[model samples]
Target: STNLSLSIDDKFIQSIREELTDLQRRLLTFSIYDKQTSIKDLSKESALFLWFQLFKDIIFQLPKSEESKYEMIEQCRQYYHGNQEELTNIEKFAQTYTEQDSIHWYTKQCFISRLCNKALRTQDIELLYIFRYYIQDLHKRLSLEHQSFRNTELNPPILTLYRGLKLTHDDITHFQSNIDSLVLMNGFFFTTRNYDLELESALKLSKHSVNILPTLLIIQVNVQLDHVIFAKISSQINNSNEDEILFDIDCAFKIHEVYFNNKKNVWIITMSLTNENRLIAGKYIETNKREIEQG
Candidate 1:
């Protein structure tokens, strides 16, 4: 007779981390593989989406506290324990950070960006909750910039943006297949009007591995669309150019085209902003509001 035990790998741990976004998520997501006729499936989907909105709203509404800020810095210290420069930056951040410096710190791409970007990309709710104060500050700054766009006459009716990056062949293939589908980016979308392709964006293929693709995203936005919020962020941060435009989190885009530019030997994917978020979650938000008011 032999005894067998189950083992979880890094990949399985990652999937579990993504699924467990909040304390209440277990009630909604547990037994996704089990067939249960007790509840309507669509309702569960709606509830999960609604929970995300509610979770973010609650985090944003919570009062800023010195304790939360200190905890964030401490977590940064622990997370970057092996990196001396990041630990030094964490110490400085703990001692001298002001509310207004949030946007600058984020764009500086230091420890804050490192944590925030990873949390967003991986849907790491625990890390996101810890950094809620800074996240709210960044969102507020972008919101103000977005609002100011309405009054600026210099703002164009149509804007073109570019982002240079490298992706796996599978990533490019997914884009190619989902040409007309909606793309909901997990975090802030960074693009520039005059993007010079970065050297790092070009992946060097070797005999051992050649699954990389250089991707250049061409995003066009109709400035007339008021549903999604985006703003020019170059002026907000130091040591930056004027070409940076940032789309806020949770904004949805429609993929219009995807093709390989044979001349440049890179993939060119085009997308446009859309109001799909409102289309999907507007009603749930209203119901959520009503339930909150009733409770």
Candidate 2:
């Protein structure tokens, strides 16, 4: 519950109350006050309401109505989902606003960045995918904007402030760092059931840093092992019959247990590196015992 403890400034809250619709405000209130209201329960409209309210203090203009605001939100959602028609509509919408003076343009970028963070925090993989599309879109926009500014030789303080308020290279890097941290944390919670998703997350994390290879390799080995064996080993570890497992780049093997034919079995899983980058591993040791004593 750090989410429960999250507090907004009174001024910001007041501004949100003024700008958000009655239902939107209620959703925000319930999300903050009611501990049982999960983020997933909120509809897309509610999510967009929160997204807009997050930047109420900085945004200079407001959408004319809840319906119009929701339209904007839907456009973003559709664009992220790869709707070609919506993408064209969104591009047209972006062109309607002047890059330096347009609150609409700036808000769109903030919306994407904040939504990505929200998706990551809530562990919504589907939402994360949608946010990623917009993240890439925002990245391209920033790059082009930077190049345009250099070409036009317009480096005014106001334009610089506008760029600072919108997405930047540092902002994208920070967003990606949050993603890497989430992937690494998710890898630790991997089980046989979610092996594919966990492996995908681990692979994405590996692209960010080589140091994660050992951790990824460990999770991969755990994922590839038989579920029955893993279950029994996990149970033994939980029961303290086996010591807690430790993971490292150089640590070669781990010993654990499994059950077969109503008998106790022991297993040793070993790991090694082919080079600085590649990992190889194997399992050995299988001994059944009528009565295996606990540690």
Candidate 3:
């Protein structure tokens, strides 16, 4: 019997050791192990191997210095000035892995999130749009699988990208139509400062009857608005001056009371808003149920 073999030169091994980060090296090692241990697993492992290399090439090529950081920011700002062909090629490359089923859904979401963060940090609108397309596809797939709630978790970063790009009204409405109401509301929580839109999203969720989170989000947003802004919105609801009054003041107060009664833990609300705004501006309205009972 004869066996075929190949050898990797020491120079090549040394080059890889110098070039690859620890994470990349570990992924490569796993790929090799998967290939040798189970032939059937080779496809997925190989895909991951390629994906990691591409990830490094695209994401990790930048140096880890402040100067490099500024350069990356500037590069992202001027991405439009780059060769169109090159940008299109990069977008196409990302699309390939994004459409593949070899990676786990959570892993894919995490990878896309990283790409989104980088895109935002660098103001790379082209890459951001590419990421948004992938996320929209993911949301569709997840909706079919009845994992739409989990899909909601994947939306905030994409929404941030939209805000960064200053997407048109049609673009925003198109996206809102494709996603679940909870996701739309959650996205609004992070991406929009408009009190009317926030209230509208919350009201839409309230119709579903199980959407306590949106109600809590509404309360959070209401508490955060500047006193003057809040007063104007309150006045609109009170005087029926708004074109569409989703809920009157008493109705809104009732919903807030229900939320406080059901969710006694203040930390839940605080934790939910942790990543939402740097300054969590919501004042928690204290429930007077205990006082009423004592009386």
Candidate 4:
């Protein structure tokens, strides 16, 4: 009886060892294939905890690129501190972008464009407009830093609007005004029974020269290309106002740089009239390459 009991205990130990070895083999195989056990097998809270643990482990295993490290540090900081650092390395990262950096920007633009399109479809025009301006701001920062970005095979459709906007500041302003006035200008502003006609008249009056030093003078009569439209115009072409002139000069230099690259100048103008704000942009193809070069 004593011998039989000892034998039974030995067999039980062997069985436990065999079960552990099989389990270890299966776990190793799953890890190799990047498979996780079914979530259905665990409670929701347990699954969430497991996911967080796995995320931490993968983050630790990432290669030691500066960006990767910085991102990891930021994630950990934000996760624990409930906010990001005020002096975040965004500026540093933007400065370091080269032609290779264009891919990442392009990827970012693509993702944002999808979101913007969804907003547009839902008639969330304000949100869509914000997304458009955000992209412009990003591109301007990248361009001003003189970064060369990689060419993307798939161009975003908004690039057409963007290219057109770069023509002259007024051109962008005109485009933005058209969008805004389309939404706001109705007979409600005036007792005129011809509200539709008045809106059409207003749009006609709002048209400005798309040329260099485009005329922006104001007038009284409600007519197309009239002074009444320019009366409320915000930007003036005086080379005297030092601060304003410097801002315009900066824009001029940016156009010069883009022209040299065989690219058209696309300018964006943000303007506010009364309670409404609008964005104007355009694309202007340069014909005087020799003249520009001489200048």
lDDT of 2 by residue, 209-228 (tens): 33323111222232222111
Specify the highest-TM-score model's number: 1
What is the C-alpha lDDT profile of model 3 across 75-184, one tens digit per residue?
A: 43355356574455445444443433311222222333334445544435466444444433333343333232234334342111001122223433333333211111
181-260: candidate 4 lDDT, tens digit per residue: 21111000111223233233323322433343211111111112111111111122222221110010001001101111
Ranking by lDDT: 1, 2, 3, 4
Pick by TM-score: 3 or 4, better one = 3
The TM-scores, one per candidate, come to 0.73, 0.21, 0.22, 0.16
Question: What is the Cα-based lDDT of residue 153 in candidate 3?
Answer: 34
Task: Tell how far residue 173 is off in model 3, in angstroms.
Answer: 29
TM-score of 2: 0.21
Tell me which residue pairs clash in candidate 3.
none
What C-alpha RMSD separates each model from the true structure? 11.9, 24.9, 24.6, 30.1
Model 3 misplaced regions, further than 4 Å: 1-110, 117-127, 147-266, 270-295
lDDT of each: 0.65, 0.29, 0.29, 0.27
> What local lDDT score does residue 134 receive in model 1, on the 0 to 100 scale?
86
- Model 2: colliding residue pairs: none
Against the true structure, whose lDDT is highest? Answer: 1
Q: Is candidate 2 or candidate 4 better by TM-score?
A: 2
